[model samples]
Target: MNLKQEMSHSPQTVILHQHPLTVHTCHTVVVGSGAASLNAADTLHRMGQTDIALVTDGMNRGTSRNTGSDKQTYYKQSTSFTDADSPLKMARTLFNGGAMHGDIALVEAALSLKSFYNLVGIGVPFPHDTYGQYVGYQTDHDENSRASSVGPLTSRYMTEKLEAQVRRNGTSLFDRHLVIGIITTPGENGDPAATGLLTINMEAIDDTGYGLTLFNCRNIIYGTGGPASIYHRSVFPKSQAGATGIALEAGAKAHNLTEWQYGIASTKFRWNLSGTYQQVIPRYVSTNANGGDETEFLEDFFQEPTPLLDAIFLKGYQWPFDSRKLLENGSSLVDLLIYIETQVKGRRVFMDFRRNPRCADEQGTLNFDLLGETARQYLTNSQALLPTPIERLKKMNPLAIDLYRTHGIDLEQEYLEIDVCAQHQNGGLAGNHWWESNVKHFFPVGEASGTLGIYRPGGSALNATQVGSYRAAEYICHRYTQPPTTTDTFLAQAEHLVQHRLKLLKNLVVNPEQPSNVLAFQQELQRLMSRSGAFIRSRPALAETLHRFQDELARFPNQIHICHLKELPAVFRVYDMLIAQIACLSAMVAYDERQGDSRGSYLIDHEEGTHRISHQGMHFAFSLDRDFRDQVCETFVKLDPPADSPDTKQTTDAAVAAAKVTHQWVKVRPIPEYTTWFENVWADFRDQKIFDEKRG
Candidate 1:
């Protein structure tokens, strides 16, 4: 068989699962095929609506099916009758994270109970005890033990269950179709309302590249997942190219574009190395570029002044990489050390759970008894104090090994290569409490909708997806019978958009310069993002990167030429990522430079230093350049209304499509109250007790 036939027959391909597209009109058009999209469509069907079609670039090409850690978590109402945890309380805790989320946290909390039940009805098997209690655990940043799981495939299970319901309900499915942009009509409320979608045919490879398909509908439900793949080292599934840029292009406000979550993950499969993976105390092994010189490196960095076991043990609760961990020679120092080892010292690092980490002396050797008092006490109490790291992992979560085994990494016998990687985005197509964007009828669901504040517990996103999707679905169902205000002018405007996009794609396909290959461009963008855009952000680098990207934006479609029809999508995805990075980096720099301190995942290193290092042929690069090191930091942040403030004017549909609307750095307000933080992390550890009640 030819390559096309071979790819078409692959399970990942959309051809085998292709559903006929006959009707162009529907009440709602749901973009994406992830759990969030399918759930939204399923909810629509249950609400007795039949005219809805779910579109995706390809079937099962999302984080829901492709990403997992030792275990995936889902949050909801407190299942323990002895504990008092209300949705309002959940909302308050969410609000405490930061103002980036606004009031959507409240909405998410209020609806999570019903959302959890909806998932149960759809067949997600969350663990429940014999007493009819849903036993829960404490995840990162959560003060309460509200999270539950069904092993590492919780999201995969959700996606499967949701997909099955979607199929059973006979919701229209359009596989291999990518929604390039959103179509909106001006509503009676003076806001732009979604009326249709602009899509690309991924199956048809022709001279003009992707075939365009425009679907007119009253509501547009966007659930394309997060911008996780925008960075060089990311835990996102390979195919998750989000539509946040298009949503922004269509005049949807993006919230908390600055806030993001970063952690260590395996580079090969892009799976997170968190929770039990850290609790198992894996050996931090490094190899030199020539591939011969090897060393267990963590001990060399943590010298005698810092407690090695304490730092390693802390990695369990503090899963996300934080700069503050560098203070007093803390655990986060492990991330900085690994970053330097890999990116600067020309070495590769791996997490070897096959053996417990080795130490400088006999007493320093990692053991269950050597762990910080809290970790040691808990393991001893739970009867999980195993000798080997893999054994400990099996005791804590056996599925962690099975997950890796399924991915060809036998945790019992092999090392899981890892690096500090981009895990999640706390920002996306900005939407409201009900998941509605600035544009009226456009609803951004799941991670695609930036409803989260600065920081959230590990599994809160799954809840956010369920809560946000269901809320958007509820709002959409209520408006099911309401007629869309589509007009001759709206159609004319929509046609203009199609012509504009076609013209752009034509220019992309028939380019003479071929200035840069999609891979090279993608690499450059990812490198730039990983450096100045992520974790250890630099103001000068961010400014320079933005200036560079703005130039490329001007030359877009002309700069990157597509030689093949299949390459067309990459060009657009790269474009989307570039634009998204521009917005993300800009917000990150703006917010970090002002805050001037570390909080949650938003950390900016203000240290003054310079060094010359080599890594994989790249020349010397500083985390903070001389210009920025000497520059003054903003002591106080000037307050302004939120990005979706009522005062902001709605851009015209023509203006939105014409690229007339720019991503302006709006004035940010002061920090709100009800913030959650711990002066002593160990206190939180003692109080929350890693979501276990051993002490109790």
Candidate 2:
């Protein structure tokens, strides 16, 4: 299905604070252009809600469009004819991952096949067997073979297909608009309800005052993704800077903010070095900053070649860095070694695929017989037990090699630089089964929603995004079908907030005397977060970083200086990043203070911890918080003045000092046990009582 380029619509213009502002009014405003947001708009339009718009900072920029692995998997129900599966069983599998809400899991599991078929119907070429069965394979944290993929660019294809459908539907596409704030009004129950959005048009920044724009709509489907730019070492694409902070400031509670996935990823091309990349057992080499003094570092710790080679092969299956795998010289040891070499010793690490890993006792000979049972049998079955890693990779999956060439990285000629980089956040803004936040009318779908728990199946994120987007759109079209309030009413509700933002924009626009500090601020914040928040966490470091980030956020526009109007978007990105950092750091601090031990994808460095791993005079002591895994941590913050708490006075102290920041740990919700009686369910479905918030 080929389609022409989509253009942005001309919105009605209005003057605010002496600057011409564009006003776009729609029934539903989807605040991103990723696969999830596009699916939501497409589904909404198909369901008879024609007044839809998609607003994005960039139409072609996001993790879904730019990032993937060796074989990007999409998890769904078992589709093969011989496999036995049901929605209830899949729900139990998802719920078994501690701290996940059972109802959301059930919804995702029940809708998994529907969502998968939707992509299939839109021409995503998910491969199937000659017998007309969609074959599947097992992924991490999975008991069933429920994962499938279409090569290294599965997500890219999904995004393109969904986007073509949305463009053909004539949905309004507002590209290059940065969402700075979410406008809310008082609900009937006295809680804040989102009514609109405040955005900055990137193209008009030079001629207008910050390119200020307003989106007054009845509903907002926020799919802007997770906070990827907060980390200095991340596998997320360079363009994926998330707007989660603004949503948190708009009274959306965040869940499980501390749980994140980290893995060894190639730094040069920013791709996950999983699947066949590790299965071939590439040599782990380190060198000085100038690309000299090359050394194979893994041999320094391992006395033999068999165990080390097996660990490298297992790294393909166990890709994510799991703390539990550290005790037995497991695959996670590979990550720790890489971390020490790059971060502590200040050396560059690379994977030499051209040569197989060699040990002192091996005498430069490849030994296939010494491999472990799992690695040996897998390689033997795939006919990949060749002479070198490159030969094995080429024989097994040539598409993996081709993927690198497309990005200008020739694996056959050069080595690939790698780092233990942050990959995915298992948590984000809180939402119910319908993906609606506690703040009424606000929905956070895709990676922006805190749907996944501490641990999840590898490709479950893709499934969750489809299910959540469809569910949110269904709810919007049926239950929340009312049009937005009048433009005058929207302005009345959002005037003070708009005026305050304009004042800040005016101050930033006039500050040319000071040199531009956007890059400095961004680098500093990313470094602070990567140091204190990524994979390794310490109580003192988290607390101190929280204080520092809070101070930085409070001093936002005052300390930030921009020379040209074009720098406004970058300046605002720093502002949003700072807020996100403060919230994430605050959550880390609270988790540490609550006696939360290391669990999931991170390790809490404690001297008297229960577990310890040592190699070459480097010792790591971490406590496994097995009990903490059963509970979910929730965070709610107010960096700006709260509308509900009008009597609370603002102060000059850091945002944390003047704001209300709260964190609480609660028991996870158990899986719902529903009656399977047919007649009773049919009556409820006929009456439309299932859509009621109370029942959900």
Best by TM-score: 2
Task: Please identify model 1 stretches exceeding 4 Å from their true place.
Answer: 1-23, 100-102, 360-366, 484-490, 509-516, 592-595, 607-696
**Model 1 alpha-carbon miss at residue 377, Å:** 1.6
Clashing pairs in 2: none
TM-score (C-alpha, index-matched) for candidate 1: 0.83
Each prediction's whole-model lDDT (CA)? 0.69, 0.85
Candidate 1 lDDT tens digits, 132-205: 78878887777788888888889999999998888887666788887776776677668877788877777765
- Scored against the true structure, residue 307 in model 2 reaches a CA lDDT of 79
Q: Cα deviation of 360 in candidate 2 (Å)?
A: 8.3
Tell me the tens digit of each residue's lDDT in model 2 across 318-393.
8988888887768888888898899889999999888878762255446888788998898899998787888999
TM for every model, in the order presented, reads: 0.83, 0.95
